[model samples]
Every structure is written in structure tokens, then in C-alpha cells.
Target: MGSPNEMVYIVDDDSTVCDALSSLLRANGKNVRLFSSGAEFLSFERGDVGACLILDLRMPGMDGLEVQKLVSNQASIPVIFVTGQGNVPSTVRAMKGGAVDFLTKPIDEAVLLAAVEHALEKDRIARCEALQQADLLARYHLLTPREREVLPLLVSGLLNKQAAWELGITEYTVQIHRGNIMRKMKADSFARLVKLAGKLKS
Candidate 1:
């Protein structure tokens, strides 16, 4: 079974190529979308989900590399470049630009499916990490100015008294801010708070 929430996008100028690739992916229980050109593909707004692009390397206008550039900022959609004749230069460029795989036509069914599976999984993990980063940022935004200042100090293993001295605040007040930081960050333990802080810094 496959979830429609996971999509496979095919962008090829040739209708025959598009139809064949779409059929193969659909047979594998994947939801497929087709486009005649990179412009068409980029214009369509995509939803947040697990998805990947099967891009034809050569096109009449705005080739695969151009499309890859357009979508480079979007981490949710991983890419696989398929060319009539895949070359070393193109393959190297695609890999450097973060394509999951570089494929040539007439493509092998098993290899294409494998690459698609890997791409879907990559997209899944990327989306998950992005969601987690967003959640962490939201939580961090809820902290007060003083709480924000104390977060790094306490996470750096400073004693409350030491932190109080650094900030020129009473230890009692530092303890109160520490409690607020713990609650605001929704951290169950100091270790978890430290981990969250590390993620934010990274």
C-alpha cells in the first residue's frame, strides 16, 4: 500500500517518456504527477509531504540543472536526474547539487524504483528534521529575554550561583528563571534542555 501523501513528480518533455515513467511508479503504488517542462513543474505549488522529482536532464527550456537550482532551497523534494545520455560532467554536477541519483534512459525499472524509494525516505527524514527544528524555534521564541540569556549559561554546566554571579542577579532570581526556562522549553531534564540548546545553536 502507498500513501498519496507521498508523491513522485516526473518532469520530462516527451509525453511518451512521461507516460511510461508515470505508469511504472503508479504500478509500484506511488502517487505520480507529470509535467512537460521545468517551468510547468515549478509553477505548481506543492504540499508539504514526502516527495521527489524525476527530472529529465535535457529540455527545450530551463533544463534539469536549472530546475534543480530553482528547487534547491526546498529540502522536502529530493531529486533524481534522468537523461537520454548521462555523462560524467552532468552526473558530477547533479550529485554536487544534491540529486539522490543520476539515471539514464531507457531507464532500468528496478534501479529507478530503488532510487525512488531511497529518495522518498530521504525526503521523509528531511521533512521530519525541518518540523523538529521549527518546533524547537517556536519553543525558544516563547522564552523571555532574561530566560534566553540564562539558557546557554545553565546548559554550559554553570551552577545557578555561578550563573547568578555572571549575570549580577541574585541566585534566587536565577533559580526562578531556570525553572521558567525548563517549563518554557518543555524540557523534562537538564540533559534534554542541553540537547535542545545544542540543536538550536547548530
Candidate 2:
């Protein structure tokens, strides 16, 4: 699950549009942070949490595309483009730039809400995968040298006798190291251990 404080950041120079969208989201039990411009939004600190950005495409100074580039470099924040007058070229640019959804104003409440939900869910899954990868790395780091040496062969479906022979150890010692590997990795089964190793490989 994402942090309870996770928000839908709304960046629009229009005060009315920002307020309306903020209120709409807040009414549906979503946390919101309203920013008057792209520059203002870029100043905020980000973390490994799930949230989406609703940005006006034609904002003054740094536009939405520029904001998307900046945010993409800093974190994997999904963007939704909102514009009063969207052109084909601009919409194409935003989509190619990794905007999850492009919305034109006056926004439909249901459509906007649905898009936000989808973006938030995507962010949630991404954050979870990142956390899982980090945990796997930490577990991998905890393995002893012998256990580490055994892991590749174990994940390759090697039997205890084969792994023992390959490592110049007895089958009994191979079994012992395998147990330690499983414990350190918090892996319950051979399949789980293989999956963890695959993630580490990636």
C-alpha cells in the first residue's frame, strides 16, 4: 500500500481550475497539493511513494512538458495533462513524454477521477516492485560467501550432489548452505528462491 498521505499534485496557473479540481479530488477521499505553476511544483521534495501529477499543458514559464521531463528525471511520477485548448501536436508530445492520460478542460468529473485512480494504482505497483527489489538486494547482501556461491547453482536447478561436486564440498555441506541461503533470503521454497534470484539478476 502507498502512504496514506500520498497526494494528487495539481499544477495549474488558473486559480479556479486548481481549486475546483482540488475540491473534487478531496471530496472523493484523495489528498491533493495545489501548485500555481510548474516551477512551484518542481520545488517540492519527492520520495519513493505513489502519487500522480495533474498538470496544465500551457502554463506560463516552464510548461507541462518541461515539468514532465524534470519530474521524470527526479522520480517516476506519472503525469496527466490537463489543458483548455489541446492541439494534436501538443497531445502527441505529452503522450510520448509519458503522460498516462491527457485531459482537456472543462474536465469530466468521472473521467478525471477514473484516470487519477488508474495513475495512482500504477504508481502503487511500481513502488511495491521497487521495494521488493530493494528487499531482495538486502537479503542477497546478507548471504555468506559459501551461500552466495551455492545460490547460482541452486537457482539453475542443480541437485545437492551436483552443486556439492561443483563447489568441491560434500552433499551434506551443500544442504547446510542451502538452508542458510533460504533463511537469509526469507524464501520459503526453491521456486521462491529462484524468483528472488531472477529479480536480483534483473
- Local distance difference test, per candidate? 0.92, 0.90
Runs of candidate 2 with Cα error greater than 4 angstroms are: 1-4, 47-49
> Residues 116-176, candidate 1, lDDT per residue (tens digit)?
9999999888888989999999999999999999999999999999999999999999999
Could you tell me which residue pairs clash in candidate 1? none
Q: lDDT, candidate 2, residue 131? A: 89
- Candidate 1 — worst ten consecutive residues by lDDT sum? 69-78
Question: TM-score of every model?
Answer: 0.96, 0.88
For candidate 2, write residues 50-123 as lDDT tens digits.
Answer: 69999999988999999999889888988999999999999998999898999989999999999999999888
RMSD vs true structure, all candidates: 1.2, 2.4
- What are the clash counts of all predictions, listed in order? 0, 0
Worst 10 residues of 2 by lDDT: 1-10
- Model 1 segments beyond 4 Å from truth? none
Superposed Cα deviation of residue 59, candidate 2 (Å):
1.6
Question: Which has the greatest lDDT?
Answer: 1
Give me the displacement of residue 7 in model 2, in angstroms: 0.9
